[model samples]
Target: MIRAYAALEKGGELKPFEYDPKPLGSEDVEIDVEYCGICHSDLSMLHNDWGMTQYPFVPGHEVVGKIADVGSAVKKLQVGQRVGLGWYSRSCMTCEWCMSGNHNLCATAEGTIVGRYGGFADKVRAHEAWVAPLPDAMQPVSAGPLFCGGITVFNPIVQFDVKPTDRVGVIGIGGLGHMALRFLHAWGCDVSAFSSSADKEPEAREMGANHFINSRDPNALKSVEGSFDLILSTVNADLDWSTYIACLRPKGRLHFVGVVPNPISTEIFPLIMAQRSISGSPLGSPATVTQMLDFATRHQIEPIIETFSFDQVNEALEHLRSGKARYRIVLKH
Candidate 1:
């Protein structure tokens, strides 16, 4: 087995050390990681926030790597091809979600963190069936976040059949929100960026948003009432759905992709009043991931990221957790 450096979760802290590679199965491909994106879910998993977590966890799902070696059964991928692996690394292919092309929710869905060792290291093994080919338009390190942040935002936009002229509102201007703005703007929509912080206005506008609204102001809420065709929420903050619901025009759809650990205390009255619908989406289907890459390549759309070395993972995570990253953070080998 090859030895690579990995940052492990030890006593609630990540410490760097050597780890061994497991024997490759016929369906597995060994990858030499070029970049790994730090995800918010990694922090949640590291702390056992969702409860089922294994220790010594190597937490990263947004991985971009090169095929260093492949097992005999693998035919579709060749050595040296650049590829990206996302949150869902494996799945039970016969489930309803799989049959419907929504592999992100397969009940036995295998997250990169949950099953195999993740990409927070120099080398990783991934399922050949789950890796996506990188388009020529994206740089390897620059593309890591696309597997998570890009696919997460683009899937809901596609599932909703967002149109060119649709009036779109994106809440929360962090990593997901910034990417949402990029996608929505590129889709030819009238995009409005929402944030509770007034300081986010300049960067929000630079990301191609036509309007920037500070949701804390009562006047701002009044002007936005019934003004949106769709609202894609990317914030983890506790929300008063009534306020957001009022911002939607009749028959509008609101999709929430963020996770707030607290149960959403939303009232159902607005659902009946305006026939509005609320839904949640996980990362994209394997098929949709390919489509998103194609779109990103064609439109010259890419995420802005700060790069860190493999050993500096802790600093990167701290930056992300402390809300200092401009948009996304990635680690390079």
Candidate 2:
């Protein structure tokens, strides 16, 4: 039996719950969760904001744990091996995207919490392919968010083929943006940070941003026109996107990793004239995550995080809801 905190209904408080899972499949592994990160996606799912959440939901996707059990066919991961799991727990191994090493793009990929119990528990299970082993140099307690937020931001750099010499801009100096600033800087790009908050300028710079643009100021936005090779928007809030579109150089791209609830509205002319493009991506494939983890280990880059005991999960959730988390929150068991 697995013991976990679960919401009995939509918008309900999480309470103690337990269940016996079916026998593990041949390719499955059970993880003894050591730490789990609280993501905005967890909050969204808690309230059924996406309208796809199931009741008795255990909402955690950013997981770091040691393998407690593995099925007969598991090979790469063994019991007692440390690992991390992200938003996705499984994908059909036979799909074209999976075959091409783009399993995150698999149409039938299974979300960690979509219709299943997740990692807010004593133990959780996932297919072997989605479980990424943590490099020995990485700290397990703070590595959970890297599986999700870290990968979400890092995948774009790889997928878009962002170059070391390119000028890159990151919007919103929060969870994903902070990591973007660090990664882009380490990648040797001239990195800029765009934030509505003036207070974030110093922190953004500290995180490796070479320039800071006050996103709230029109003139500040105008000054950098046609300057960036790529601008990664990591904020969910809607802003003057048309202006952002204009900030792009010819053939530049404006990519989104944030989950903005409303429809994006921007003039098509700017994009048409400049050959600029707007795109968005979910978390990276497992292979991409491995690369990201390796890079982070090599660069000694880690998310700015605050920790809480698993017993205080509700308080941790409230901290994240209040927007007071230093950047990311981790729950230690």
TM-score for each model: 0.95, 0.99
Candidate 1: which stretches are off by over 4 Å? 2-11
How many steric overlaps are in each model, in order? 0, 0
Query: Model 1 misses residue 325 by how many Å?
Result: 1.1
Tens digit of per-residue lDDT, candidate 2, span 1-333: 999999999978889899899999999999999999999999999999999999889999999999999999998999999999999999998989999999999999999999999999999999999999999999999999999999999999999999999999999988889999999999999999999999888889999999999988999999999999999999888788889889999999999999887999998999999899999998999999999999999999999999999889999999999989989999999
Instruction: Give the root-mean-square deviation of each candidate in angstroms.
Output: 1.6, 0.7
Q: lDDT values of the candidates?
A: 0.85, 0.95
Worst 10 residues of 2 by lDDT: 235-244
Q: Write the per-residue lDDT of candidate 1 for residues 50-168, one digit (tens) a residue.
A: 88677667788899989998988998898999999989878877989888987888899888987456888777787787889898668887898999988999998888899998999
Q: In model 2, which residue pairs have backbone atoms overlapping below 3 Å?
A: none
Evaluate residue 168 in candidate 2 and report its C-alpha lDDT on the 0 to 100 scale.
97
